[model samples]
Target: MRKRNTLRQGFACPERSTMTVHDAVHARRTIRKFTREAVPEALVKAWIDGARLSPCSANQQPLKYKLLMGDAAAPLLPFLRWAVMIAPQLEPKPEELPPAFVVIAVDTAIRAAGAEIDVGIAAQTIALLAEEQGVASALLSLRSREVPVRDALHLPEQMMPALAIALGHSAMEAEAVPYEDTHKYRLDEDGKLLVPKRSLSEVLL
Candidate 1:
């Protein structure tokens, strides 16, 4: 495979390699803190490509992507709400913000009301592909207030932003631990984020 190009200055190319789907699934985590290094544009495009190939409900394929990098990405940070369970603390500091973002939009003209399933699948596909490429990603959704993403990006009337994926090199590590009383994830003594997962025995019917 041909190597992807990175921005000449601050961007660093993610390490490319073949990773099993299982490995990518387990290795992927919701990264909130990120280094200053920018994610390569080519890698972002590849991730969107991965989402493009994801399954769609009734094959409507209404999903659209808006790629943002560097200064273009700054406008989006204010609209994203991070881990509510561990907010304020888990929120990325100004210096630790993701250098790239992919806004997942839905073309209402294609399949307006029933594209939630397709959105979920595409988001997960993007996340998994980013993990396989040695990049960190956080899938974020807007909170109570409406985000003016459409206006910011000049999206068509039919296209509406559904989710945003923050991307960059990770500044922190997170891991899944055994589920206890609550499903909420927490920070360990060492500051690592500990996400809880129910055992297979518990999840399997």
Candidate 2:
């Protein structure tokens, strides 16, 4: 069935492989640079379908998603402006400022119900699937009072808004700066791409 919230008409996957899924998990990073070319709506739907299968608490399916595309910037863009300005300047580009916007509330259907885990799982599922298909996204969190995107989208009142992931086909490639293993992380060796952590010998008792 076609997803209710997206205009994506059809998925365009030529090579089907779970390795792609794994690669997406390891390779996916927050992408801020996007090409003006709009990703096919159907492809986006296919990713959403993949997300729908994420496991929820008791499979209660507490997630509700809404996608924002094009100039539909009124909902969450202005709030993101503060971050955008401070954000590392994007690499120079020539195309239309790619389809850019927010992933309005990604919330669980119940309040204070610990559904965040389920919601996060679904969001990551969508993101990883996007990466496998050559699309990229940035997961962002912000505080704003300028507008009510929730009501604008007519999302349920019970759904709690989570992270707002800005998505599109990135014009630039992103890298996963390596992070130190939690057990190996330490302050003395901290640097870009080199996360701090404890050695396995030190971690294992």
- Number of clashing residue pairs in every model? 0, 13
For candidate 1, lDDT tens digit of each residue in 1-205?
Answer: 3233454455445555667779889988899999988677877887798899999988889999999987887767677889888898899988988888999889988986878889899999989878777778999986521237777677788888889999888999899999999999999999999999999999898
lDDT of 2 by residue, 1-205 (tens): 1122233235445355444566677777666567776766566666667778878787667666666666664555544432343243442243524474435354434435666677677778878777765667766655642135565545676555665666677665444433454523212322222223344575688
**How do all models score by TM-score?**
0.89, 0.67
lDDT of 1 at 117: 85
Top candidate when judged by TM-score against the true structure: 1
Deviation of model 2 at 137, angstroms:
1.3
Which one is best on lDDT?
A: 1
lDDT of each: 0.83, 0.56
